[model samples]
Target: MGTSYWRGELWLGPDYGLVQGQLGHTTAHAHYAHQLIIAVGSPVTVELDGVRHSGHCLLIPALQRHAMVQAPDPAFSLYAEPLRIAASDLQRCVEGVEASLPKLQAALEQCPRQPIADPRVERALQALDATLEGKVAATQLAAEAHVSLSQLERLFSRDVGLSVRRLVLWRRLRLAMALVLQGQSMTQAAHGAGFADSAHCSRTLKALFGVSAGQALKTLNPRLLA
Candidate 1:
């Protein structure tokens, strides 16, 4: 057995993403995006709020603390922004063990799109996305959204289900992962993603996804599609 476990395809995007392959174990963590895990070949185990869940299909809401206790070989994990993807939409994609990648993707394609109700929040998100490679301040984002700092925070909470800081961190992780896919070292990726150091990046990665930067790169080898 090796540390490298994941295989197959990985598609990284700003609002939605997918990674499929020999799944890797993950520690308890919560993220800003909704997660859907559909197992292939065998069932996967997920632990949420101290309770363990095992099945071929599992859906987790944004910011809900959970962990992948056991991710068996061949699994498709989807991440969608809660602002755009409704929980009910993801529920329809849960088709158990018989679910194939094509079927799951088709379901995802058919999922209804929800426009962000708040223009301020939309502006803030776009501003944040554009500045992930550099330093960003809360006040700066508030200015971009044309709202006060406190009001911006409220807008993010009501529309995105998490703090703007946490969302920025999550997007930074995605950028770091993309840099890794482009052949950059973890240290380089960390700096490129505006982290203080590689150790900082690694800690954040492990905290969120239960995998180290080096481990993720190895696991995703030759299969990552950015």
Candidate 2:
């Protein structure tokens, strides 16, 4: 069967469950209580420990702290119990999570901590860091690197823990935040970030950060903005 764009759910433990049925931006606030495992069909950018990732899958440790910003395309997410898998087993578990949701549920029976090396996906990271305020496409990046789009996807999955499109979205979000910090109006930020309008920017910011642009800016420490 073909993947359905509008069909997706969130598998929290037996106690918690969520079903998403919309085509808009989504965001989870910084949570320190539960680890989260997210699966996406489109590209998605995740910010954790001050780093941004885009690619296939993401594993966020509980109490470690992070934020998720969805890409423009529709996506799906699953949140499992932190104790279900150890740190060392994260990679394998993430790789297998979607294939057998039931097995993943069973594996969560034992929460083991496995330590894995960072994927160290740097080329795309460098490109994003350099062009946060500019317009760039995954195809362009792949071409520049002399790799096909699929190869870039594999590299992003293996090294960055996300996808190329997600990285772009994340970069746009970051740029939006920076513009807001600079005292730009919502309209200005939206236009600067290549969004259609202020409302579009507001929707995305709210979905990813769980706050409107005004609210987010108010919470920023003045020193950090400066």
Question: What's the CA error at residue 197 for candidate 2, in Å?
Answer: 2.3
Q: Give the per-residue lDDT of model 1 (tens digit) for 112-136.
A: 7899888899899889988988997
- Please report, in order, the local distance difference test score of every candidate based on alpha carbons: 0.77, 0.52
Question: Listing every candidate in turn, what is its Cα RMSD in Å to the true structure after a full C-alpha superposition?
Answer: 2.9, 14.7
Error of 2 at 224 (Å): 3.3
Cα-based lDDT at residue 142, candidate 1 = 99
lDDT of 1: 0.77
Worst 10 residues of 1 by lDDT: 217-226
Of the candidates shown, which would achieve the greatest lDDT relative to the real structure? 1
Give model 2's TM-score versus the native structure.
Answer: 0.45
